[model samples]
Target chain A: MAKPLILVTNDDGITAPGVRTLIHIMKKIGDVIVVAPDSPQSGMGHAITLDSTLYAEKLTIDEESEGIVEYSCSGTPADCVKLALQELMERKPDICVSGINHGSNSSINVIYSGTMSAAIEAGIEGIPAIGFSLCDYKWEADFSQAKEYVQTIVEQALQHGIPKGTVLNVNIPKLTKDELKGIKVCRQARANWKEKFDKRKNPMGKDYYWLTGEFELLDQGEDTDEWALANGYISVVPTQFDLTAHHAVQELNSWNF
Target chain B: MAKPLILVTNDDGITAPGVRTLIHIMKKIGDVIVVAPDSPQSGMGHAITLDSTLYAEKLTIDEESEGIVEYSCSGTPADCVKLALQELMERKPDICVSGINHGSNSSINVIYSGTMSAAIEAGIEGIPAIGFSLCDYKWEADFSQAKEYVQTIVEQALQHGIPKGTVLNVNIPKLTKDELKGIKVCRQARANWKEKFDKRKNPMGKDYYWLTGEFELLDQGEDTDEWALANGYISVVPTQFDLTAHHAVQELNSWNF
Candidate 1:
């Protein structure tokens, strides 16, 4: 039987250690193809390059790889997935995995995440997808501890299949292999960034602002991803792209329109 | 009684007719403050400018307006909202209204809409918010037909708050006011873009591509936003930022973790 075809991509540029680790792991499971951004796209949520042209080029990233190929695109994460599916790949990938991102995309951060947006784009195109993120946000963060769990989740997703119109947001807690607990399928915690803009002036004495914020978790529910991560467990939240608030439809219907 | 303080914004830039029309109508309803992008930010969904310094400057768009003020920001729509709320506004807005966008943001387009993302950002910040868009994509599309309806919706939303954690995605069909069949509360139709990349060669003899697509509606439900728009009615889909697929949690939990 042919090995399952796996598409690998990320928001943190092609050379980031996080995606390199993800590609390394996916190679052991199937034929791998990597199409990612040429530069970092950390907070580019679902953005597509509409006003500008896109450039993608084939390149070699690994020396010892046999069935692995890579391409880097000059666009957002969502753009990379769209380009790969429509122009690059000959057949639909069995699954697409994004990230092992340098920072967490566990809660409300998902809305601003380039990482999850790639996975969600694949999900929109009828491909099973997952986005993996680590709790640490360092250039040199250790990714070895996540290798076993990452392989396991991808293996399970390939076997069981993710539900239609949904993708997985898997966040690994920052912990050693022995200190790590198991995994938990959980809901997205209700949380937000309390945005505080640091106002400053440039050399010309003109006003400018730097967006800085603190993540504030509002949901204390044990079933939430926040809780699972805090308790040393990896969190897997089934994220969907259908934005309709289904429960509010009835109440809205009651409004005189 | 003091008028409601309405925060107005859009992805089509501060000078676009769509947002200018929105500001004109909103001024009749309240003391309006406009904080919008300096240039078009189409398709920049929920994106924020974290890696770059942001610049915002107060400007006068309408010389005759007394209580209306505007600011142009060098950031995404989501960043504009965050700046308005954190560093600009003296108090929380009574409500936030985004767009009067030059194109539709119905169905799956919501995932890639900067208009709706601005509204969603406000919703995440605990403010009642709504995003309005027309089916017409032309820069000079007539917004007059939407004025009365917009006023009514805003009045109603201010009177009866939107449900917590949800923002309204309102799309107006391209029809005369008399030809309209009123508004419909609906679910987001299942749909996706059938992407077709127009590959071309650049001046330097290098390959480049232009992203283009056609919307394919997969859902035949009569209660969907697509159905409402095609039938000459405005579609209002209550959109939420919490992306968790709650119904799928149980099924996913069945997997061995």
Candidate 2:
């Protein structure tokens, strides 16, 4: 049988070490074609470059890698998926995987995540997709700890297809291989950021400030992704792109619009 | 009873006429406080400024608008809401409304909309919220047609709050007052963009590309936001921030993670 075609992408740009690690893992399962942002697109969420133009070019970072085609995109991560599906690939990939991002995209952050947006874009197109993230925010975090675990999950996914209208958001804790426990399928933990801006003046004596915030976890449930990550286990949360509140629909209908 | 407090925000920068119009309309039904992005943050989605410092300051557009306080934040629309709740506002507003944006955020765009993100941010904080958009993408788009309709809807909302965990996403058609039809509450249409990248060469003889896309409407249902807007009727779709696919939970539970 022909190898499963896998589309790989990341919000951390094509040159990031995170995608390189993801590429190494995806290569063991299928033919890989990478289309990722040319620069870091953290916090971009599902932004597409409608007001601006986008560019894509084929490149080879490491020549020794085989059968892995890659293109760096001058657009957001979501734009890369659209370009790959529309213009780059001849046949649709069997699966699409985004990231192994430097920071976590679990819970509420998923809505603001470029990595998960790539996966959601694939799921919208009826393709099975997954997003991987590491809890550590450092550029050169140790992803070797998650190497075997990610490979196992991706292999299992390729062998057994995911359900319709659903994609996976997988986040791994920053732990050594020996300290790492097994994977846990869990729900997104309810969490939010406490925002505070650092006000400052520019060189021109004009007030110009920067945006900053800190994560604040509110949910303490054991079945949450936050709990799993805290317990040294890899967290796998099934994510959906449909923003419709099906449960709230009836209650909303009760209102006189 | 005192008038309901309505928090207003947008991604098209704090100075955009679209948000000004929203403030005007919302003020008639409720006390208004504007907390918006300092610069244009289109397509930011639910992005929060976690890695960087944020700033916000009391803005005084004019002395005539005295009772209504305004603050412009140096962050995404979501960050604006977070700051408003955490460090800016003394207490949670009764309702939150984002945009009267300069473009359409009707279908799949909602997932990537900074306008909707502000409203969703407010919703997650348990505040009733709504995101308003116009089909016109022009800076000088005629908003007179939507004034009466928008006011009516906001007044209705003030009288009867939206359901918990849900926010209204309203899209107005760009038509004259006479041509404008009444409001029609609807569901989000299943739609997507067909992306096209224009490849070109930069100054240094390096290739760069621009991202562009045309909207593709997959669902032709009459009770959809796209259809309503096309027919000159205001579209109101109840949107939710919960990214969880509860139906898929049982199915995923069977998977060997």
Query: Using TM-score as the measure, which candidate wins?
Result: 1
Question: Cα deviation in Å at residue B84, candidate 2?
Answer: 3.0
DockQ (Cα-based) for each candidate? 0.89, 0.53
What tens digits encode model 1's per-residue C-alpha lDDT throughout B47-149?
9999999999999977655557789999999999999999889999999999999999999999999999999999999999999999999998999998988
Error of 1 at B23 (Å): 0.6
Off by over 4 Å in 1: A64-67, B64-66
**lDDT tens readout by residue for model 1, A1-257:** 78999999999999899999999999899999999999999999989998899999999876654457899999999999999999999999999999989999999999999999999999999999999999999989999997999999999999899988899999999999998999999999999999889999999999999999999999979999999999999999999999999999988887766
lDDT of 1 at B166: 97
- Candidate 2 residues lying further than 4 Å off, grouped into runs, are A63-67, A198-214, B52-67, B178-181, B201-206, B220-222
Docking class of 2: medium
Q: Spell out the clash pairs found in candidate 1.
A: none
